[model samples]
Target chain A: MTKTELFNQIKTKKSYLCVGLDTDIKKIPKHLLSSEDPVFEFNKAIIDATSDLCVSYKPNIAFYEAMGPKGWQSLAKTLEYIPKDCFSIADAKRGDIGNTSSLYARAFFDKSASGMSFDSITVAPYMGKDSVSPFLEFENKWVILLALTSNEGGKDFQNLELAEGTEVYKKVLEVSKNWGDSERLMYVVGATRAEKLREIRAIVPDSFLLVPGVGAQGGSLFEVSKYGMNATCGLLVNSSRGIIYASSGEDFAEKAREEAQKIQTEMAEYLDQFLK
Target chain B: MTKTELFNQIKTKKSYLCVGLDTDIKKIPKHLLSSEDPVFEFNKAIIDATSDLCVSYKPNIAFYEAMGPKGWQSLAKTLEYIPKDCFSIADAKRGDIGNTSSLYARAFFDKSASGMSFDSITVAPYMGKDSVSPFLEFENKWVILLALTSNEGGKDFQNLELAEGTEVYKKVLEVSKNWGDSERLMYVVGATRAEKLREIRAIVPDSFLLVPGVGAQGGSLFEVSKYGMNATCGLLVNSSRGIIYASSGEDFAEKAREEAQKIQTEMAEYLDQFLK
Candidate 1:
């Protein structure tokens, strides 16, 4: 999906929400375990319930990978089930050398080759530009580079003090601008550091930012919009556990929609206040 | 596999060679493509041939993942076929948040869960301590963190001036020491920067380093040993194309063995000089 198309989806939906499909087997309703593929069934319900409430769906790849080949089949099905108008993200934090990285690009972006093609894939920038440049080759496929992650580990290496008071992730943001433009590039700015969005916006104002760690991770949606919102509402605030795991009963999907609706309603108000 | 077990294998085989199973569909011989599971067939042949000379097999995950579910099945079978004594390295280079990282750990380390129990898996250290520490939870499993990569883009953020003389990778080597010890932790030092091995050794003297980019990527095996070797012969120098794709014709396995033997012979000589 093009940046303009994604922004248009947000404008029409009045929500910049990205529902994260961080599904786990043990945590899901026990009744579904008898099914051939529990992960896909769970995801299908979630997508069906909240497709209109959110602009994108981000499936954390680790959950499906844990289930092995059957899990991959489920992920492919889940990808196909998502409404085409709604952007899909393979939250597979994959990056490698030039050639190997290109293969990874094919794994996620070339649906014919890998059985799944996501609009974007979250990439860790430890290996630098070439590791990321491969994913950009596929038209309309975005590379969401990991910048200030939400996890406690994000403090370890990402926040390292470089010369001239620059942090490692900011340096990542600064130097990576040469590799690709805002049209094809995005940054994973954890919602925990909502304040830092101001600094991030100053560096790459137009590029989209995939903000994980809202709700269950204790990040406020309002603060994210207040500090991170750009002209195009350049923030994809992701909520994974809080939304998907909202209920353990048979009405799990219904409850999930309720949670997504609540967040979407709040987000629409943010769009109105920030944009208007 | 434990560090002591790995060191013993190096002593027993007198070779620290790691065969990289970067099996690509387009690159493998046409004869194998006709097989029901060509990827597995190709990996089985390579493993059967070089199982004696190489101490470990590092299957670059991209090659298998690009083929989807069947590819993962091939990887599982290949993992089962590897000799019990020989170490297995899933060159997946995967790392995420704590919960997600544990899932990745289970995907590789917990055979009961994912049907593949690699001895160690390569992890990108971008997310920091918590992201890496989860993999260390599994007994005897290892996390080989990428420090200085071989690709030209390694110069981008890895060589950044973090301080007066400290570069990003060195800082990764320094800070990561706090997360896990040499017993459970190693680093990926690309062979292109063989000179940097000496400096890397100063920071991480005892921890084993998985050095890739040998013949195909223009990294000399001798330089890697001279600077990177320690008391335990602490380096698993990998050669993917030079050995696996040595002969694309009918005698592919034989040619692969011949190429592996050539490297093994050189490695044995290094072991004698370094250990004796």
Candidate 2:
């Protein structure tokens, strides 16, 4: 989807929420296990319940992949099930050399090739331009490059200070600015480091930030909003465990919607205060 | 395979050569297109011809994945076809958060999970220790972290100067040292930076190094062998296009063997000088 279309969705939904589908088959309701495709069934319920409450759905591909070919089948089915109006992200942190990356682009963007085309796929920038540019070839699809990640190990290299006083990920954004525009490129800035959003926003003010590490990771949605929101409300604050795994009972999907609605309500207030 | 088993394979074959299965459908022989699975057929032929000449087979996962589900099937078949003694490296540069990384580890290291089990996987360290440690959970499986890549874009972050006068990749090696030892871990130091191998070897002396960009990318085997060799002949120099795509006609696999044989012959001499 285009930037303008995404902005319109954010406004219409009154939220910049991107519900994470980190669905673990083992963690889902045991009753669902009797079904042929439990992961897909679970995701269908979650999407059905919370589609109106969020602007996007980010499926962490690893969860599906851990289950094998059947998992891939579920992932493809889930990708097909997502509403076209709601942006879909295959949070597959994939990147490699120029040729290999082009194939990865095909695997994610060319549905005809991989049987799944996401609106965007998260990428790692360690390999530089060749690793990232291939995903940009699919017009309108996005490449969400890993910048400042949420995990503890993110400090290992991402936070390295340079002689010029720039952290590694900031320099990553700076160097990568030459690769693609805000229209086709987004950045993954962890919500746990909400304070860094202000600095990250200064570098790429218009680009959307897929902020993971919210609720369960102890990041406040309000802090993520205050520092990260742009004129277009370009902050996709994600909540996976806090929402999807809220209740593993038969009402799991309903409980997920409740948590999503709670987040959406707060997001609406921030959208009004920040965008008004 | 363990380090001793890998070293034995090197001595048994008299080569640390890693044949890259970068099988491009368009580049394969036209007759193979008639087969049920062209990429797998091609890989089967390549493996049948050169299994003894090389110590390892590094299938660039993107090449297979670009073809979709059938691609994965071909990969599984090819993995099953490789001789039991030969090491298999999934050249899938995958890394994510701790939980996600474990799933990825299962996807590659556990055959029952992903229908393919590789001895090692090349990982990019941009996300840091958590993204890598999970992959090390699989006993005897390896995590070959990307340190200094050979692509022009490799200079972007891997070569960045830190406040402590250490290059980014060196810091990656330093910080990652605490995560896993030389036994379960290795580093990918591109063949183009032959001189840098000495410095890298100093940091992780006992660790293996997967070196790509040997022939097609203009990296010399002699220089790579000179600076990179350890007491265990610690190098798996990879040559993809130069080997697999050696010919496009019916004689493709035969020519692949010939090219591999030539490299193996040279590698034998290097082994004699370095290991003797």
Candidate 3:
């Protein structure tokens, strides 16, 4: 999906929410185990329940991969199930050398090759330009490069100052911005570092930011929207555990909708407060 | 495989060569298309032909993933077929948050969870300690961190100097060395940057270095061995296309063996010249 299309979806929904599908087999309701593909069944329910409450769905690829071939099958099915109106993110965190990365781009963007194609795939920037440029070659497909991540270890290297007097993550932002425009490229900035959003927005004011670390990770949606929102409302604040696993009972899907509704309502208020 | 066992294999074979199975379906010989699983059939023949000539097999995960679930099945069979004496590497280059990284660890390290177990897996260090530490928790499994990559884009951010006066990749080596001992940790210092090996050696002198970019990528065996080799012959120089795609016809396996033999012969000389 194009950046304008993504923003239109946000405006229509009155939410910049990107629900994360970090589904764990061990954590899901035991009753779903009777099904042939429990992971897919669970995701189907979650997507059905909350599709209208969010503008995008980010499936953490590791969760499906941990289950082996069957996991991949479930992942393929889930990708197919996500509504075309809602943007899809593979969240695969894949990047390699020029040739190898082209194959990765094919895997995620060319559904004919990999049985699944996402609107965007998260990529690591450690390998730099060539590793990331391959994904950008597929017109309209997005590359969400990792910036300031939410995890505790995120500070280990990302926060270190470069000799030119900028942090590593800042340098990553400055250098990588030229690789693709706001139309084709986005950044992953953790919501836990909400204060940094103001500084980050200054660097790439128009580019979208995929913000994880809300709710369960203790990032306030209000603060994130205040500092991160752009004229086009270029912010995709993601919530996984806080919404999907809200209830483990048979009403799991229903309860998930409730949690998503709570976030969407708040997001609507923020859209009015910030964008109006 | 343990570090001592890996070194012993190098001593026994007199070769630190790592044969990379970057098997692309389009690149393999047409005759293999008749098989139920052409990718697996190709890998099986290559493993049988070159297992003796190399001490390790690093399967580039992107190629397998491009084919989807079937590709993963081929990968599982290929991993199981590799000889017991040879070390195995899943060149997946995967790393995520703490919990997500644990799932990635299970995907590569636990046979029961992911249907394929590798002795080591390549990891990207951009996310820092937590993203990498989960993989280290697995006993006897290895984490070969991407230090100085062989690609042209490796210089993009890795060569950036920190405010503290050290390069980013050098700081990665210094800080991450404490994450795991040499027994369970390794670094990927590309043969393309053979000169940097000497400086990298000063930081983590005893840890094994998985060096790619030999042959097809224009890296020299003699140069890498001279600067990178240690008391244990601590280097696994990888050659993917140079050996595996040496011949694209019926004699492909035999030609692969011949190419691997050529590298093995040179590695033997390096072992003698450097270690003796």
What are the per-candidate TM-scores when only chain A is compared? Answer: 0.98, 0.98, 0.98
Can you write out model 1's per-residue Cα lDDT over B1-276, one digit (the tens) per residue? 788898999989989999999999999999988899888899899998999999999899998899889889989998999998998999999999999999999899888888889999999999998899999999988899999898988888888877556988999999998788999999999854556777898999999999888989988888888778899888899999999999999799999999999999999998887762
For residues A1-276, write the lDDT of model 1, one tens digit per residue. Answer: 999999999999989999999989989999899988888899999999999999999999999898888889989999999999898999999999999999999999998888989999999898888999999999989999999898998988888888768999999999898789999999999854555877898999988999988899888888888888888888899999999999998899999999999999999999988862
TM value for model 1? 0.98
| lDDT tens per residue, model 2, A1-276 | 999999999999898899999989879999899998899999999999999999999999888877766777888899999999999998989989898899888888898888988999999999999889989988899999999899998988899998678999999999898899899899999854456777888899999999988899888888888888888888898889999999989999999999999999999999888762
Docking class of 2: medium
The C-alpha local distance difference test score for the whole of candidate 3 amounts to 0.93
**Can you tell me the DockQ of model 1?**
0.80
Q: Better model by DockQ, 1 or 3?
A: 3
Candidate 3 lDDT, tens digit per residue, A176-204? 99999999999999954455887898899
Decide which is better by lDDT, 1 or 3.
3
Name the regions of candidate 1 deviating beyond 4 angstroms.
A191-194, B191-195
TM-score of 2: 0.98
lDDT of each: 0.90, 0.89, 0.93
